[model samples]
Target: MPPSLPPRRKSNTGVIVTVTLVAVLAVVGALTTVLVVMDDKKSNSVADSGYNYESQAPTPTRTYDPGPSSEAITPTQPPSAASSTPRATTRTTTTSTPSGPRPVLKTKDNPLFLGENGTNVVTCNLPKWQSTPTAAQAFFTAALPCLEAAWQPVMQRANLPYQRPKLVFPSGKRWSSGCGDVTEGEAAAFYCPPDGAIYMPFEGLNVQANKNMIGSYLSVFAHEFGHHIQALSGAMKAAYQQAYEVGPDTAAGLEISRREELQAQCFSGMWFAAAWNGKGSITDTVVRDMLEDGYQRGDDNNPSAPRDHGKRQNYGAWQKQGYEKNRTYQCNTYLAPASSVS
Candidate 1:
């Protein structure tokens, strides 16, 4: 091929140099543009892959004691559910975003339901369970800090006060607190708002009546912690006052109690979801044991028992909802229908 020449000109040398410079500049600019586009795409790819729940660490398989109890022991009562008139009122929080201030959603109106999603708590290494008060006490003491850490962000986001409640492992079958005297049979474990302490009597756990799995116990503790969440968020006091005004033992009052209880169950499930396969000790098998125990914790089958907690199906249903969904707003039982909570 023959190279083409420019038209005859008086300053051909200068024109040739100018044309060569322009061509070189064009190549350099094109290369720069390609590099910039490639770099931008690389940055976007990294940003898009940010911390997904599904990308968490694999839960290590742990050996569980398969010895099943004759009957599952129900998580009987949250002391706050009892007939107590609370003077405190329901507290609401406001949310802000780029657009403008947003009022809480009607369905997830509770203050605790502010976060985008529930948190995966820090790695937790729980002590072995020997079915003794001392062992249980140690396990719970170690766990309280983790719970505090996990919920701290949510509370802060909601503009709610966050603090660790007192953890008390009562010794005897019958024990009394600022709330009232409670027997082992009445409440497996309870949260008392007066002293802001979680009461976990060894007898109340009924460790013998269930599989010896740590996650099962953790779920129970988390459920009671759910009550403390209610108390701190003013949900407990507000629900109590409403129930008291309508008579705590009446149908309406019981329905309110069921919503409170089931919501706690949902919260418990969220905790399990956060911890399972993401942190220490909580594995799929552990969650399985917990769910198996939880399925039987409902009050439906027992004729004599008060229907404060939902049916066994709904009982497990809400927990799985929290676990699978892993969102605080999704656990709102208050907005649920009478049939669903019932």
Candidate 2:
């Protein structure tokens, strides 16, 4: 219009300007989006239910303790010793003296610690296992009765009532649980407190662990089942309440988890050792196999992994403590030094 450039040239200049503006706006929008997302991530708390895994796997239905800090809490009354624990805490950390398989019934003052021997020689009649889910279920089924036989006497002496924990063998590539959803191989086996059952997904247990070796898997099962035992005793509840006070993901919080897990390991070892001593299938060779396999089952070796379970070395050591020592009192993980648990 001002008699400057040709019409075609002017039109081309306008198009270039339009494209430049659009590009500038796009860059600005992208930057703004990134900033917003970063801010949101920074603001999210651990209690947000955004995080998935927990130390209490089979994972506890994460009831975030939005309450007082661990140090601030006082111990409360526990459930009836024999009654089913209400969606209570599950796991261990601490050691009590193990009364040799036949010791005087302990007192309320001398509560029956995990490893204190109650009665002697109850053999678990377990079959050699196969890698299939059905076989695994059968193996656990057979083994549990033995555990009940082994542990009931201990509880009775303590005046604690014993209740059998329900068992579930999830049968699918993908499954949902009271704790959360599962992808193949995401969980090994867990004692979920919410449902009061032990979930050992045959597929999940077999994910890198299924060698048709009964002792190897049995070691883990006994540990989780030890959790069930802990639930039965007031010990499991006390441990959880302690953990809640400390904070589940924090260092102290993690120690509590490690202690709980390690104690369970000790309890399992005691069971196996007790079985080995009797007419049971747990041989020294089986114990050796389980110890070797346990190196792989440690829960918190990686940096990103939640520090719920102990190191691989500790896993072996704690389990060996129970098997070798075979004293229930020695199974107390809480009394051990921090380095021992860590």
lDDT of 2 by residue, 1-342 (tens): 110111111112221100000000000000000000001111101100011123232332110111211110101232233452222222345455332322222212124552234323555667777777787788889888877776777666555657798988888755555656654434445665556677666654542423555666677577767776666665665665666677867898777776666667666666765566555686656655655444433433233556465554565566656655444455666666776665
Give the distance in Å from residue 157's predicted Cα in candidate 1 to where it truly belongs. Answer: 1.2
lDDT per residue for candidate 1 within 33-111, as digits (tens), equals: 0000001111100000000012121110001111222221112222231232322234355343223222221223555
When summed lDDT is taken over every stretch of 10 residues in candidate 1, the lowest stretch is: 21-30
TM-score for model 1? Answer: 0.68
> How high a TM-score does candidate 2 get?
0.66
